[model samples]
Target chain A: MKHLSKVALLVAGVALAACSQPHLDGSGTGTGSGLGEAGSASDPTSVAYFNETIGDRVLFEVDQSTLSEQGRLVVLAQANWLLANSDFTAVIEGHADEQGTREYNLALGARRAAAVQELLVSQGVASNRLKTVSYGKERPLEVCSQEACYAQNRRSVTVLTAGLSS
Target chain B: MKKLAASLLIGLCAFGAMAQLAKAQSGPLRIEITDGVIEPLPYAVPDLVAETPGSNQIAKDMARVIAADLNGTGLFREIPAKAHISTITHFGSPVQFADWKAINAQALITGGVSVSGNELEVKFRVFDVFAGQELGNGLRFKGTTDGWRRMAHKVADAVYSRITGEGGYFDSRVVFVSETGPKNDRKKRLAIMDYDGANLQYLTDSSSIVLAPRFSPTGDRVLYTSYETGFPQVYVLNVGSAQRRVLSNQSGTMSFAPRFSPDGKSVVMSVTEGGNTDLYKMAIGGGKRVRLTSTPSIETAPSFSPDGSQIVFESDRSGSPQLYIMSANGGEAKRISFGQGRYGTPVWSPRGDLIAFTKQNKGRFHIGVMRTDGSDERLLTASFLDEGPTWAPNGRVIMFTRETRGSDGVSALYSVDVSGRNLKRVEVTGGGSDPAWSPLQ
Candidate 1:
């Protein structure tokens, strides 16, 4: 009960902080003075900020690896975040919806990951700081066997890891 | 007559003196399984007469396994033990043909079991009830007490071959991906089991994802894809030792769908480099990889012909995935699947006469078989999701993965006869998919 109350208090505090900084919601206009409190959405260079504010993933059409207009924008934002956060390296995980054979899905996932890597490299993100892995259809963000869930499952996620200076 | 000669040759090779004498005395009793929708041949397998104390339970269980094996084929129907009018009390007992024929049983199998310590000896004889004569000489299989199921399978294989004129597949094993957990976070491990889903052993843990395990032609090793390195790569595992080594480990590429050549000396698999997937062959002993297909489109799931001369693979180079045939080495290829549906996972039959594949059409999936030239395409099964077909060693059956639809959907192993009869789920613990039947062992 004590730990729960403490978590509630922390949530309330974070809510108050977010309400005060309404203009810092990934608008790229905030002063670069919030990097000290890393690992929070309020901190511009944190992983959580990159994941929620900048968007660390992109979805693909059925049986396609070509990026959409929105997906390209997301990748472009992700590339910018990676360029700013030099201490962090990224592992781009490729995935596919469970509508194809296992082997084909693996290849498809690889293609999707490669597409994201290409975009990031084109945007000045160092190629050496990025690695790619295809999870195929083995992992899914959604489990329902419908277009709604499949669209979410067919995605590539950019996961960031710290302390990889190389 | 040529087919019959081949059958007799197989029977003679399996059951030496008895088949020769039976070939001379009377017309042979045969069940042509290919002839569509015939009545199930009625057969009776009495519990083997226990020749030693404490052997009665093993005797009954062994006969049960044998009966189940034969009945599972969809070609034979068992005349239940309760329906038997005459029971043989001794292994040397004479014909009860009149009683079996009265029950309309065309075939009768009688056996005896003797147990000593852990050593078990089982002997059985098959009789053509209508002909009032033995179909072949009595045969015996010796094994440990723990291997009673295999001994029974040996009996069933012999009886099935004698009747169906095809090599028995009952004595084989299958390597497959055993699955667990829920849909989004499912965990998979490599598992091996007997053809009838017994004696299961895990070849790998569920710590990492594994898929599509294919047995070596000799059944001593297995090839499968694993994400141990966080990238999909092919690995070869020794079935006996549980030792595994990564086979394809280029830094920036991913490889999967590996199958052994007929000689088991080389493997052909799909490898992805720079977003383009193509088929490549590599030696089992580690050598330079040979590129077989250089198409810009995805090409994977390559299966070798029984003769190891040609390879049949699924490629989407022509817009949608279709079956194609090309030389084992790099060369020009000819498209074989021209059907409306998309075809993938084209596995050549061990007999070299048919290619089995997974087809998706009109919002449904099917397990289908076609001739080498892609003619005479026969869809064996249709479901919400059915894919990754592996042929039985005899080429008379195909086992594949079938998954249900929904958020709670799960995958399981199922098999069907080549004639599309006897579609049944294999009784596996937990869930399973991607079955690769080893050659008859």
Candidate 2:
């Protein structure tokens, strides 16, 4: 009975997706196979876009807010995306693992968000378009008792909002 | 001569029978010991009676969990089920005194679970096993199936209180931040659960982040930090009604690490204005704010003494975060931590004797306690990172967060006695952090 219900839900989801986008290629055909993508060809300063959106969140190592190279790359991609789309304002939310003190974690979360904000500004994004907040270790996407869950719990996220057009 | 020998043998048999009768007539076992000595009372938890299918498993699990909770405190030693000679099949059955006495059990607990229309009814009785008398009448708790674990905790609380003459913390609740995602981009939400980490209910939907929720003296209100207004600000939440209002609204400034005064009339917290953080106090009813610290250095983690006469806090004015003490009325604060490490989060014991703090040194974190006069420093538990020490009401134990290190680290709640004994991990479904113990209810 459970399997039958799951199959019905899957069919319903596929039908909804098909109904929503009739103009797009339905057979998983590649559109950006040419010499340049649409936006980059129009704008000379536009950088290559990576599909890795930073999940609108950032996480920190236990007791530390220093960003890793992967985290920096995500922030750079976000910065470039924001730079290309000049009307966007973002809020950086910092988070810590469940390991450290609450007050310290809050401070560390702020520091992580601040680090992302600094990097974005350094990458030519406007300072006024950025705000920072720290959630500390209050929210977890995964609820488990072991290390996998804890590792996932420490993060920072970037949220976009409407701002003045460049 | 043969007749004489036979008569002597009969006399020996009669003597043996008399001795047996005398032993049976003696009163139940009782033990008395002075305070300040470490002695554990022996206790037995027999398998609980089940009234329906799967009820037996529920009863057994509940009994075992309760026993573990009690024994983990180091105040009681479980007299293994193998030693429990008599089976407790019902709540009202007369206990077999001889069987319990034979195993040297000082106390015994018997409970039963009944299911009625999706509601669970748990009934429990605590007995002075040695005295062959019931310590208290059987207690019955009725709640939903999800509340069965809490019912078990309530039973443990009753038994613990009856035995120790001190309030049990089992029936309490903890408000902490639940973590997820990666170390770089984690989502946080305000979550609450039973003190044993059961019935985890998320208060906020992670739409905005929250942190460090402390229960009020009455346990009806919670004070915590939230970024809903685009900055870290303290908020008061009425747990029963789920209504929330901002506690501090100082424009453009940051406020965090809030704790309620013992009288519940005011909250003490850390406020950052300009680049300096200091401690401040404000009425819970939203009134005039009073500055508690006037320094250029970081002063955070302010906790009230039991009587609300003094405040213990952590300050980095001395170049490192160390414990400090000041009058509740605000005066020159004196440093109270002289230990060899940086101390933070100094929480005064509810008994008004010592202050529990988190000490970090030599790449390790420790939960430690010290006298009010900067003496008698004792580290209770050492770990990769242990912080946020909150005192149990009796001042006999301290609960803090412990994090283990690896590529993928873990965080969990841990408790330790003041004497540096009986360290145990608190079980929770997901990882837990920033545990603020509530006052004895």
Candidate 3:
């Protein structure tokens, strides 16, 4: 019964997300294939379009917020996507696996978010357009205790917000 | 608090003038409750007598609640009331010590209740069955009928104090974050309730996520982190008014892991800016901020010593999270945790004797404690996920958050005594975490 309810909840959430999902016209195949300057939105891009289509999150290793080469490549693509799409502002939401202390994880999450935000800025994205927040291990992409899920749980997600414009 | 009850008990025994019998204990089976595992002391509690006619049900229920509070401690094993060889009916009747002893009941409790309109009164006494004498003078608590449970707690407190020579936490409360919904997008709010998870009162709505609530010394105010403004910041809540405001809203900064200073005049919290998190102290009434640490590595979770002269916090300057101690005014900090695991959230015990923290090692989390100077380290619990240890106001038990492993993982509050006994899950409404024990009321 518990398993059934959890499955039902997941289906409901996915259906809602698919309903808002737009057509993918860019070179992005929706498969975080690590391609740069991916996912253009209707000859343009919105914040949601950047996140949902181009993949706004990047994963990290255990306790290490320093971006690996692949992580840097993904962020560079993210930076290019943001530079191409000007009206969109991104807030990098940092998170960690559920293996460390709550406070340390909070700081670790902050470090992860900061790493992403700095990469975007160094790539010429305006610093004013980037904000950061750390949910730590309080929020996780996966809930299992194994290493496989832990890898997915440690991530920095660029959550876009509607800026001073409409 | 002890003086208040001591003075009241003295008043109750004045009329009896049975001075020698009052303090007499000739042959009671003494339980010292050492550091090692020991058997629980067996005891029994009979239904309390209803002095007033309409209070029989209330009296009976109060006895059960009192018994549960004591049994929940894991130090006492309650012999079921049904196992009693003798039943208590009269409020002033002498205890049948031989009957209790026959049932292996080392201690016995009897109580009486009187209810009139919205008012209720409870009086109870503990007896050492083996010794055949009342352990202490009877204690009577008077309050509104709505507060009968509190009255019951008072009775349990008196009994616990008389038996253990240590004060009871029955009358205390805990403030924690009540969690619900899915793990990915969980809803959380600040809640206050009795120590046993009774009388739950939500202090904040679920619209914004809240975490790590710490109570002021007076128990009337709470400091917690909220995401109301789209980022985590410390908020001070007036528990009575159910109103709260940002305690720190420094632009472009995220702050969390707040704790009240012993004096309750200031708060010590962690503020993260440009990836660097550090500990800072600010007046509760809103004033100048004092930088307590200047480390480039993560430094947060600052707890003030009971004397308000020093602070215990966690820092990762040594490449892993470790406990550190420094002066309240801020300066060089000496590393304290030399263990193999990483230690964080080092909260100074209210008694000023030890510091409780969450240690992570060998892919397991444990709630552990060490002396203020970092000696006598003992891990009280081990699990897949257990963190955030908050000391009971008496500093005898540590409550923490435990999240089970799996996709359907849930976070719940749990408690264990400092001696590593009485490990029990705290019953709360739905999933709860980050439990902070309130000082005794």
Candidate topping DockQ: 3
Q: What DockQ does candidate 3 score?
A: 0.23
Clashing pairs in 3: none
- Model 2, position B394, has a per-residue lDDT of 59
TM per candidate, chain B: 0.95, 0.83, 0.94
Candidate 3 lDDT by residue in tens digits, B1-441 = 011111111113222444344563333545555576566788899999999979989998898889889888877889997799999988688888899989988888988888888778777778888778777667667777777777787788777777776777898889999999876568998888989998888888898889999999998889999989878999998887777899999877999999988889999999999999998999999888788888789998899999999999999899989999999989989888998989988989878999999998987788889998899998888877788999988788899998876666788999998887767789998999999998877
- Mark the 10 consecutive residues where model 3 chain A has the least summed lDDT: A1-10
User: lDDT (0-100) at residue B16 of candidate 2?
Assistant: 27
Against the reference, the lDDT scores of all candidates come to: 0.84, 0.69, 0.81
- Order of models, best lDDT first: 1, 3, 2
Q: Which digits, one per residue and each the tens of the lDDT, describe model 2 over residues B334-408?
A: 999887878888888888888888888866688888899989887777766788887775566778887655424
The DockQ-derived docking category for candidate 3 is acceptable
What DockQ, between 0 and 1, does each candidate earn?
0.19, 0.07, 0.23
lDDT of 2 at B308: 96
| Interface RMSD for all numbered candidates | 21.8, 19.6, 14.6
Name the regions of candidate 1 deviating beyond 4 angstroms: A1-38, B1-28
Candidate 2 vs 3: which has more TM-score? 3
- What are the C-alpha RMSDs, in order, of all predicted structures? 12.8, 16.8, 8.9
On the 0 to 100 scale, the lDDT of residue B340 in model 3 is 91
